[model samples]
Target: MLFERVESEGLAHYSYIVGDGNEALVIDPRRDCDVYPKMASKEGMRITGVLETHRNEDYVIGSVELSARTGAEIFHADGHLNYRYGEAVEDGMRWKVGRLEVEAISTPGHTLGSMSYLLRDSGGEPWIVFTGDALFAGDLGRVDFMGMDRAEEMAGLLYDSIFDRLLPLGDGVIACPAHGAGSVCAASIADRKWTTLGIERKRNPRLQIESKEEFVEDMAVALEMPPYFKEMERLNLVGAPLLSSLPEPSPLPAREFAIASVEEIVLDTRMELAFGAAAVPGSLSIWLGGVPSFAGWFLPYDKEVLLVDETGDPGEAVRRLRRLGFDSIRGYLAGGMVAWHTAGMESSSIATANVHDLCLRLDRQEKERGWILDVRSGAELQKSGRITGAHQIHLTELPERIGEVPMDRHVYIFCGSGLRAMVAASILKRRGWKDLTVILGGLAGWSSAKCPVVK
Candidate 1:
């Protein structure tokens, strides 16, 4: 038996490939589907099946594409919990790949069709369960798919699923889940790749709660759904274009950077992690996933733009840009921002103000000097004690509405942790507004600072 846990840092998603000597199966695959084929060739394994635990509301799933390419059957538990599995499986039903026998355990609290696969080797004790968002290393899946109204019901379902379907398996059953930290699907998932049910049973906060009512409220970490979830869901439902090869990036020459953008498009394929580590002064604050999407939507008119890349994986940022039709990135940051700094180019930084800083500013009445803007989603505002007089709007709407902010006042924008606030600050700066600062640690920092809360 062979298992590979594929992790995508940008999306905080984990996909799995399990195989016997003869066949392989993939679960919850990301859209970049090239590596699987090469692996199949190297291992002399035939790609046979693709499975989706649920219609994911996160990064695009690559199941259909893989199915189309490898002629693997696509299985999704949708109609009356039916699927198109080459080896159909249901609760209590056993599936075999050589010596390995796997069972599908219905654990639907996270999503209606969510599943966990329990695996045993040659009639031996069960070793691991792929708990697809139903359970994580230190957290249970947030009952997000059902929306806020059914929180109680979903929480109850989750309670039953864990008590009956999962916890009974004993300590040795390794818990492998679909997502880890940075995935909005769970409130508090540890970063560990694999953990035991026994460990989670002891350390996991949600597991400690006795009542479903308490679990629902405790699991509510107040996360905004991914901005692209709706579109991705739709694409997943029908189909998305399968890539036979990774999008070929033009080797952008240093001289033709601007003209290439004008002729083709601009992709800022700089790795976001490096961007966060050190950024260009006046750089936009969108140094995370969906950067191309956000940049295209707001700053769409950059016809001859150049990419600002990190030292590694320069193509990553370009591909995302090309995905969104920003393929005109002619070249990188012309030896990167080090070149800019060496040449004495002016660089600036946006302050990450936490909740405490906001408290200090508001209490000291310093907020009057800098425009206090809140860029969290509407859902976040529903239950929070937000800054009293801070102007409320979303990060997506900033470019259009930025003009309303007074130019004379210094601007301080913040969100859950200064992430979205930085995005807003970047958009504001692009439109020529000068005075800007992104509140660090955002509301979390503010709250920890003993800042006043006005719920």
Candidate 2:
């Protein structure tokens, strides 16, 4: 079988391709579907099937569009017992490949429709197992997905699924998983894409445990408390529905940029050093230290996009935007802000506020010293401590909690780092909150300086 892993760095997601001699299956494809066609051609295989382990939330799925474009059949498990699918795969349902026998094993922990695939070569020991999101190399799928109550229940099921269905496949079975160290989908995954079941049995924390409750509680502490998860779960009820292909990010000429900026949202994508010296007023800053994800949180879906990559890597910015389906990039800012300045147009340079400013402001407790909004999650606050005088709020809940932030005060937003704080500041500014400032180098920076903590 010809197998390949498709990886996206910014999102830390991995997709895969596996094919017997005749046909290929694309698994967990990224939104743009950039690599599948080339891989198929190289292997001289026909693209015949598309399979999604679970409907993912991190990036848009490419299943629907790819299926529509290629004559590939889409496969998903029937969720619950009576679940239906385009191609319903279930426990012990075996299918034929050139030299391999593939069968499905329901492992519903991460989500309701999760599945793991077992493969047998000729008549020897079963060669490989596709442990979708159920079992990672060193780690296991996060059970606190779907819904908390449901997630808890699923966690118990996950324990049974792993120790019984997956782990019992013997020591020599090669564990070929869909996700690797790159995915945010699991916690503490092994960096390698494949590991032997024997190794996982000996080293995996999930397998070493005996009781279901211990397994459930152990998998509970996965990273992230993202607000987008609920929405992802809603989408996963059906599927993440992958995209077939995306249009190239249309770049605008210098003249077109000025015209578009009148209506478009400006995305400054140039090197941070260049942007720091001279930048656009009201432009969202996405630099090396602060990548586009944080800025993307506040970026609305409908606005026309204007990129500010001076070195001409605006395509990278557009790829990040496309993951959210924000494809309406009117054009890029040609020649960047330098072109605007050359034409004598105005520019705005923002201050990178240090921890000292945060300390002084918190100590003073001035009513008019601008609004102090904390963007750290409740869990993070619970563990790491927060600024004594700052407001307690998570960035994910910002849209709903806008009322708590007074419209009259000069809104100053912050998170673990300055990255998210900038995004929060933009959101407040977009909502008509005037005199907005993002507290650069958030609570971590404050903590580094031994700033006093309230908790």
**Each candidate's clash count:** 19, 5
Give every collision pair in model 2.
61-242, 61-243, 62-242, 62-243, 63-242
lDDT by residue (187-305, candidate 2, tens digit) is 66777656898999998866887777777777765466554444444444444444433356665666667677778788776544455456666676666334424544555656877
Error of 1 at 50 (Å): 1.5
State the lDDT of candidate 1 residue by residue for 1-455, as single tens digits. 57888887655788888777788778777776776777776778877877677667666677867887789877664434333333334566556666776677888787766678887766767987888888887888877566777766777788878878899999878888888875767866887767899998998878999876787676543355544566556656766655544444444443444344445433333333343445554455565365633654444433544566656346676555433334334455566666656666555554554556656666676335466788876657777767766788787766667777888887777777655666676667656777776666644445423234476
Candidate 1 yields a Cα-based lDDT of 0.66
Worst 10 residues of 2 by lDDT: 77-86
Off by over 4 Å in 2: 78-85, 122-124, 181-184, 187-194, 217-248, 253-264, 271-276, 288-296, 302-304, 353-455
Minimum summed lDDT over a 10-residue window in model 1 is located at 79-88
- lDDT (C-alpha, whole model) for all candidates: 0.66, 0.68
| TM-score of structure candidate 2 | 0.75
Question: Which candidate number would show the highest lDDT if scored against the true structure?
Answer: 2
